[model samples]
Target: MILETFKHFPDFELLDSGNGYRLERWGAYRLARPDPQAIWEHQLADAEWKKADAIFNSKWQVKTSVSQPWPIRFPLPLKAGEAKTGEWSIKLLARLSTFKHTGIFAEQAANWEWLTEQVQNTEFKAQKEQLKILNLFGYTGAATILLAKLGCFVTHVDASKPAITWAKENQIANNLPNDSIRWILDDAAKFVKRELKRGAKYDGILMDPPAFGHAPSGRTWKFAEDFPRLLADCTELLSTNAKFLLVNAYATNSSAIALQNLLEDSIKKTGTLESGELCLKQNSGRLISTGIFGRWSK
Candidate 1:
């Protein structure tokens, strides 16, 4: 029952959450977005909620006069030279969308931090083996960028062309090397299958699958029906010296324990499996569960 919470992101903050919505700050812009999990009463005063620069109403309508595509910065994995302690920037479009998302999932900071530590471990560095990572369903490339910054060769896959484009834009905004990541616009399951057929292997794998989605080719993906098959195929793509496998699910009926069980049963490898809810800590000290995730590490 490990609950992973992300509270150290300087550029992001959960100011308040309640009544099926969350108030958050991304850089200097404040936004209010829908969150069914924020069912409790809000602690912040009305005036505080009113200070939002924009609010997403039902039907994905945004009510505000805020500017579009604002920039936000976050600390990157430590690197060499004066830029070692420097931060990375990304552009955010605070507009209402079909998914009611604002490009970034702040709750994933916990996973990003964990992935970075895993890559930077002394043992990993001592081995002098360059790690290759595959990121499936990598929307906007947050984790992809972080992994690439750690010197890992990354292959990022997504089903939406727009998502891949936006992710590339983020890469450029962060000033990452043009060749830092290989972008693939295809269905996650199909892409994994093709990689398996090609005998391609990766040192690490990360997937964040939606409950229900449509592939670029119009193929439908239902989590309950496709996740098991996808996991089986993905296990075959893991190198013998694999370092980690991470899976995240949002708005799904499955529990963290279920995710852990599935990974244990499908991976066919001995390792440590941990699962829990990914949460965001509000200023009121309350944790708003955003999703469930499971990770396996050697």
Candidate 2:
């Protein structure tokens, strides 16, 4: 499996990881949080770690006074050979969650760049001016905005109302076209079933599911029990000329290879398939592996 790390990143930094916690710098503020993957001795001094603006140990321990939601910008430079050559900026809001999340998964920056390329360099771009995308579990709308800014109409679905609200805030903050994104707050599996019945099609489909999730309709999502059937249904929703499918999983017992295997069994279209771990690099040159992903593209 390949190990992918973010490049051209300055809005976020992984300063250190050790003692089951990670010290990070998000734009202007610094934060420290629990990291299960950092099972080694710390490279930075404890005093340095203690100076975090916000620390989360079971609950947030605030130190320095900070804004309720701060702005962080991600610069996504297009790769060579794309129709567009300049970089695009993705602006998002950063807020500490009760569950120790900052509303941004910086490690997925690599995949975001790949998504940019797929949009700008698609063989179907000439035939299809606006590539349609379905983003399930679309937290905070980072990828959603990226695709929309590149002239794609995106349907962003998430179970959390607050997440969808936050994502909408980010969209307005960036001054994007209001018609570019369609926001849906519902259970991913149930929504997908409805889309399939309506004979809806998407050029690309992406999801980043939590280990367990609860929907507004009182439906619960268990990855192990619900993911396989969801994947099968997602494949059927893909257009015959689909461009890509991406799946991201965190805090799961399953491996990236397992995701690849499931996609192999689920996808009927022949395409290039790859699976790997997504990681962040610390200042000390060590990598903190965060999650795994399986991506397929034509």
Candidate 3:
């Protein structure tokens, strides 16, 4: 039972969490957001929780104590700095969203680190083969930018125009090359089908599908009904030398074992499969489960 948790994120922290709410620090700003998994009692004092610059209320409204849309910088790994000044960084625009999201998932930082290591390994680099990565539902482009920065060609697909635009902005904010990523705004399933038809392939594939969503054209995406089909289609797009496939689901009724079964059934490839909960360690030393994930790698 490997619990994938992000404890090394320099720009993010789970300061405190309890009482169906969480207090976190994203870069320099503190925010309070709802988390149904924090079903325990608050460990931090009321004064500490009040230190948040903004709080998302039950009505999906943000109550801010300061002006929003601030800037945050995340320190990147050494591999990501090789192309830069030996100290790579990523800039993000943080604001309170209606969905209680801060434009980034800190827990996925662990996955980013894992992906970087996989592509940077000596064996992979010795092959001198440029890796191609596909990122489905790549909101805000965090992983896409990191992969592109690592010299891999990335295809970033998202159904929301605003999310795609935000991801592009993050790319520019980090000064990533314009051609490093190919941005696609379309339904995930439709795009996969198109790629399969064109005989396209990728070395790595990542997806974080919502429990329920609607495409830009109002096409419904119900996880229970669509995920199996999507995974099967994605398997067809994998390159012969495919290195990895990662699936992440948040706040869904599906379990990590379910995701593992889905991948095991669809990929039909020999690889190491690891499945577990993605959690955030609160200041109380308690792990707050946020999502479930299944990762396959060679």
Candidate 4:
């Protein structure tokens, strides 16, 4: 299992947590957000609360048009049907109003760093082709941007138009290579199946499948029921010298060991395996176990 001991934007501190809320400072904005896992009491200076630029309330919108009743100062990067409007900037929008999710998951920072490292550390000069990466369930393309920044050719796949647009924005925001990623709007499993039939292959694969979701074609997906088969199918799409395969899961009772075992069982005929939980450190000096991650490599 790979352990993430460091991270980007140490500038953002999760200063405290309590009563289903967290106090955090992202850049200059001190804000409060709901964290169901944060069941403890809040213990921070009163000054922190007073300095917040915004507090994301329970109300949100998921539409082609975004209208905020409050004075919305912060940028919302991932919305339902928003188009990419700016270059080198984070664009946020709400696609689902059930929670405060803007469609981008912050816990993915660890996976982004991991994929970038794999791309950079590979022996590219000795290889016959450029490193090719496939980011399945690639919402907003954060991982796509990181891999592209590391000089990998990435195929970013997602079923949402807004997500693909936001990912394009992030790529521009980081000034990444324009042609580095091939964006696709499709169901991940079906796409992989087609890629295999076409004899396509990739050096690195990153997936953060939702617990449950539907495609543009109205196809339903349940991770627990579909993941094992998906992993098995993905094995056929890996290059003979593939570097890594990463699977990330959240809000599921599935344990890290369970993810590890599944990957091991599915890919044992092909490569080596490593798997575990990915976590973040909150400001209260506590670890927030965010999700399960599994990896396989030649």
| Predicted candidate 4 versus true structure: per-residue lDDT over 93-208, tens digit per residue | 32323366544465566676666556655777356568999989888776776667556789999988877886787776566768888999999999999998899988888898
- In candidate 4, where is summed lDDT lowest over 10 consecutive residues? 69-78
lDDT of each: 0.83, 0.89, 0.85, 0.70
**Candidates by TM-score, descending order:** 2, 3, 1, 4
Q: Please provide, for model 3 over 1-298, each residue's C-alpha lDDT reduced to its tens digit, 9 standing for 90 to 100.
A: 5788864677888899889999998877788899887788899899999778778885434445545667776666675335555557667777677678878888888788888777775355667777999999999888898888778889999999999998998888778888889999999999999999999999999999999988989999999999999999998898888899999998778999899888888888897988999888876688888799998888
**Per-residue lDDT of 51 in model 3:** 78
- Which residue segments of model 2 deviate by more than 4 Å? 79-87
Model 1, 1-298: lDDT tens digits are 7889864678899999999999998877788888887788889998999888778776544455656566655565553432543345333333344566778888998998888767776255567767899999999888998788778889999999888888887888767888889999999999998898899999899999999999999999999999999988988999998888999999888999999889889988887889999999988789988899999888
Task: Name the top TM-score candidate.
Answer: 2
C-alpha TM-scores of all predictions:
0.92, 0.94, 0.93, 0.82
**What TM-score does structure 1 among the candidates reach?**
0.92
How many Å off is the CA of 69 in candidate 1?
1.6
Alpha-carbon shift of residue 89 in model 2 (angstroms)? 0.5
Question: For candidate 2, lDDT tens digit of each residue in 20-105?
Answer: 99999999999999988789999998888878999998998899997979988888665465455454687888998878999999
The candidate 3 region of ten consecutive residues with least summed lDDT is 58-67
